[model samples]
Target chain A: MCGIVGYLDKVGTEGGNVGSVLLGMLTALACRGPDSTGVAVFGQHRPDELIAQIKLGENGNGTEYARKIEETGKEFGGREFSQTSAYLRFVFTETNDLHAFITRVEATGDPVEVVSVGRRLEIVKQVGSPSRLEKTFGISAFQGKHGIGHTRLSTESVVDLSHSQPFWGHGYPDLAIVHNGHITNYHQLRRRYEQRGTRFYTENDSEVVAVFLVDKLQQGRGLHTAIESIVRELDGSFSCLVATDSALAFVKDAFSFKPLVFAETDDFVAVATEEVAIRNAIPGDFTVREAQAKEVRVWSR
Target chain B: MVEIDAAGRTTREVNRAIRQRIAESCKEVVLRNPGARHNLAVAILEDAHIRIAGSAGYYCGGLIDGPSIEVEGSAGWGLAESMLSGTVRVHGSAGSGAAAAVRGGTVVIHGDAAARLGVSMKGGIVIVAGNCGYMAGFMAQKGTLIVCGNAGEAFADSMYATVCYVGGEIANLGTDAVIAPIDAGEAQQLEKILSTHLPATLRSTKPAAADFKKVVAGRKLWNFDKREWRTWQEAL
Candidate 1:
């Protein structure tokens, strides 16, 4: 089992303390998962610029890897370079071929992975708990309109930076997903997607959700439609939360095998695998309710 | 009445304090600032009243032989599960598996209940004043489950001698679950149960007991018959 959390500022004009709220929620749910923690936050959006986070593997020289990534950025006219631990962030102009650009970045020496590429989304994940994430990245000080966080317990997949979730929707910018339960039909779905030439990145079953959403969006289906289709097509006992640049959505399987609760006030909306997350994170009065079986809720800025 | 503050204490400390107060002959114990912590007031064998001022986490009031536990806010999963005898009443909703496998008890939810309510019960009376989610009373054995609001899909699947009543619309019945007519005595008994557990204001807003539909096992699942192949296929 994993813990998934989503928060959105209903009063969208001001950027609330999205990061700190997410940290509080994730920390409360730390008991659910101890392997890894990650968050995908939506920051100030510039329509013409694209932001990307690249995970430089921990095995190599940090400065050397940063320099190589800077060189690659210069090749693509990327600017605003920043580094946090093993992660490198840069802004580049909108590219016509994102897949080729990501492919180019991943080929830079030893085991470079592109964690996320989006106009407003920036994903930071590592192989540790929420406290470790906070110490490493100071995640609580982050301010934004909305974000999604996850603490993962590796049931079938290996515990590593690459296998951790808040999985970016591979080529789909600004789309991220976190899931709580296993996808029973992962192997069959993987075979079908692979036959249709979809790349499988990690052996993690949850990764398929992001890819599936990307595929649906490519087919011109809206986000809500894609999520509804996921409830129908995906065979599993899962409760999933999906976040994009402008909206957040929650989806549960027919059986509702996983636990998910949400609290809504006039000011903000918060959802987690347990109500304790929201109660401990946010103060004041709010109505907390459980998301029923085969339920989907969406909030947009 | 004794008040135990749970603000800065661990779960073990709070439970210990509760048991300690009961040992000291405190009749009524009120837990303040519960903060949705799990396993509060679990396995208490004393015959006393415990009131949780705020929301509680998983397994609240579980494994208790005697005690009337009240929650002002909601409860998490496995609320009052495996109780030998007692009453667990939640002013707010309940999480999944409320009153699961209870040998004897009364579990009441003033608001909605999530999935798997009263699942695998040996004996008890489970009541939800509001709606309930899917697979509620699934595989339940020898108990009475009641839902005042709408029942979600696959209600009461694969039960053994467990009687169920739904006051609102049932989305769909589960495999081998058949609806039988509710007799006058059963309806009056349901009314008495509701009045005994619910407050007057809350009781007035709910549907009358006479409107409820009774659901029981068809007994086809009790023993496998080759002629009932289709029913057995779905049950499996």
Candidate 2:
């Protein structure tokens, strides 16, 4: 089991401290998955470029791997590539040609994919405790209006950084996914996506969900419709959260094997795996309700 | 001794006072007026002596460390939920899910307990003076539950390391569960436990110690069966 939290503040308001909210939410869900934590902040910065979070192989040379990623960024016309603990965050100047960059990166030796990209979107992830990840990445300093957080407990996949969730959708900037539960039909879906010129980096079942949702979004479907379509098609139990620069959506599988609770007020909307997370995130009194089975809810600020 | 008058004080205040006293002292803390009102006492004591005069609401003496809590009246649901250590004694009946998920300690119920007693228990000792409800000790990882009276059906389902002692008839044992005769050593252990926790009124006319039965889980259920028919037949 894993913990997922997504926050969206409607009404286009900015001053409402997002970093503190992420900290509180993550703290509440610390018991769900205590191994590693990650956060992606869609800040109030320039929302034109896409930020990709890539996790390379562990026990390898961090600097050498980062240099290779920086070279790849340069080739794809992206500027300002940064590295942190086996992770690479690249800022793409031309978000329109991300598909070409993804394809070109896949052609390289090591497996690489865009983890998240969108206007004002920046993904910060690491391989440690939530507090450790926050301390290393300065997640507390990430000032954003909306974002998604994940705490992973490896069930179907290994505990490597590449298998960590909040996987980015191909050709979808600022679109990242976090899931809790197994995808029983992941191999079938992976095969179909692979046939369509899509390459996978890890053997995690959760990646199929990201690919499936991204496929729908690329087919000109709205975020909510795409989520609803997948909720009916995706097999097994899952409660997932998807985020882009402007939109945040949550979807529960038809059987609703996983747990997801949401607390909504006029100021903000918070989603988490447990009610304790919502309470920790927002101090004010609010009613927390469980998301219905097969329900797809979308929020945008 | 703490004399909490529930005449006007809220249940929360009474519980808080008791909790504060338990946290501060190692001496025996007696709570007067156990039946005065409904209250939920959580983390009442880490390591002290506690006595309640009346019924306790949800989660009475929850997560007790080394202290002993004696409830004069019945207890509500989730009694002793996730208790790490200590002992809880209920003079009256216990509502559903008694001792649910208790990690360690000893819970003695003088009266009957409702369904799902000791569900998912990791480790502990539970003694019920009267009958027990259905699905007792379901999915129990480890612990011991001694029932002086009849145990409801479907007891010890998916049980791992827990040992169940039922003095009277068993309605039914769940999948992979079986009943075995209690040995002399085990009987002596139960006698020692009964002497320590059982009140004089109930212990005076104790039944024959050799009549108790033990319930255990068979290890055959751990394997994954390829054929559905084989699985169903073995389960039956």
Candidate 3:
């Protein structure tokens, strides 16, 4: 079973120290999953700037990929270029088309994949523990309004960055999700979405949740309405946390097969698969309650 | 009386310290800063009083006997599971599968309990001061489960000789779980049990034992018959 953790600052106290809080919570849940760690942090919103993160292929030459990315950035008017070992980050003016920019970046050859593109959302995932995530990306240094994370235990998917969770809604800006249980109807739903020309980035079952939810948002449904529909439509044992630019929400399946607990105070709200994570990472007293079957709650900034 | 601090200590270390204290004939052991840790106290066959100051994670007091354990905070899943004897009480709520497969014991929860409470209990008494989640007492063999508040869907499904009593509304009964009328004598026994375990303030807030609805298995699944198609259909 994988572990899911989410933290949202209600009072907006200087980025909420979200990075450090999420790191500690995920570390406490390391025993649940040892395959990989993934986090999606929603930072300060820029109305006219879009941030894009890309994962380079494992076998490609790093220098070659970097050179290609730099050349593409020049043509696309991208700025704030940052490169990690296997990932690249770029900020582009919002005047550019999101789909076109993603296409242009992936066209740089070397099997480039866009991890996420949004004004406030930045997703980073790698094959390692939560501590490894800190060493590699200094995740605790990230300051943001809200965030969600995942510790993955690969069930049917391969252990790789692409298969990792906290999946970004590819076309839906500022949308990310982390799931704990398997979607029983993944294949049927994937086929239906594929027929509509929806591009699926991963073979994992949980990827369908991001696509399904983004589809609802595109249909002009409110976040709460969309999550409620998840309880009805999705068939399986799942407890998922979905994050948008301004809100964080969790939805549990009707069967209550998967476990999810949340602790809330006036300052912030924290949720995890187990109370151990919340108690170990968060100080102070707050009553922890288990999310019942078909429960959907949203906390907004 | 002795005190053990779980701060910055491994589970094995904390348990070792507890066993050491017990060996030294400490009458009472207080563990602080439990931090919702898993398997805090397990396989303790000694007679002593153990107290957890804060929350505990999965399997807090499992496979134990002859010790009265108390958790001042909420407990995670599988609390007091498979305990042959002893009493495990939590002042706060409990996660799923509380007291699962216990052979003998009394597990009491003062707050609401998550799903699957007292599942497959061979022998024991589980009392919840508040509501319980879905499918509680599923496949239980022999025991008593008392819910002072509402019971969620499919209560006591496919059980064997396990008796249930709910003081509040039941969302739905499970397959082969039939309601039986409670006699005055049994109601008095329930009242005594509730009074012995729950505090005065808590007992005042919940429904009295006289109003509890008794539930038991119809035992049709124990020996199947082709003519009982409706029961067989739902049981499958």
As for candidate 1, its clashing pairs are: none
Error of 1 at A95 (Å): 2.7
Interface RMSD of 2: 12.5
Top DockQ prediction, candidate number = 1
DockQ of each: 0.74, 0.03, 0.65
In TM-score terms, candidate 3 sits at 0.96
Write candidate 3's Cα lDDT for A134-245 as tens digits: 9989999999878999999999988888899899998778899999999999999999999999988889999999999999999999999999999889999999999998
The alpha-carbon deviation from the true structure for residue A159 of candidate 3, after best TM-score superposition, in angstroms, is 1.2
Which candidate would rank higher by TM-score, 2 or 3?
Answer: 3
Model 3: residues with Cα > 4 Å off, grouped in runs: A59-61, A73-77
Off by over 4 Å in 2: A11-16, A45-48, A106-108, A111-113, B1-236
Higher-ranked by DockQ: 1 or 3: 1
Q: What i-RMS does each candidate reach, in Å?
A: 0.8, 12.5, 1.0
Per-candidate count of clashing residue pairs (backbone under 3 Å)? 0, 8, 0
Ranking by DockQ: 1, 3, 2
Model 3 over residues B186-221: C-alpha lDDT tens digits? 999999989988889999998878899999998999
What order do candidates take by TM-score, descending? 1, 3, 2
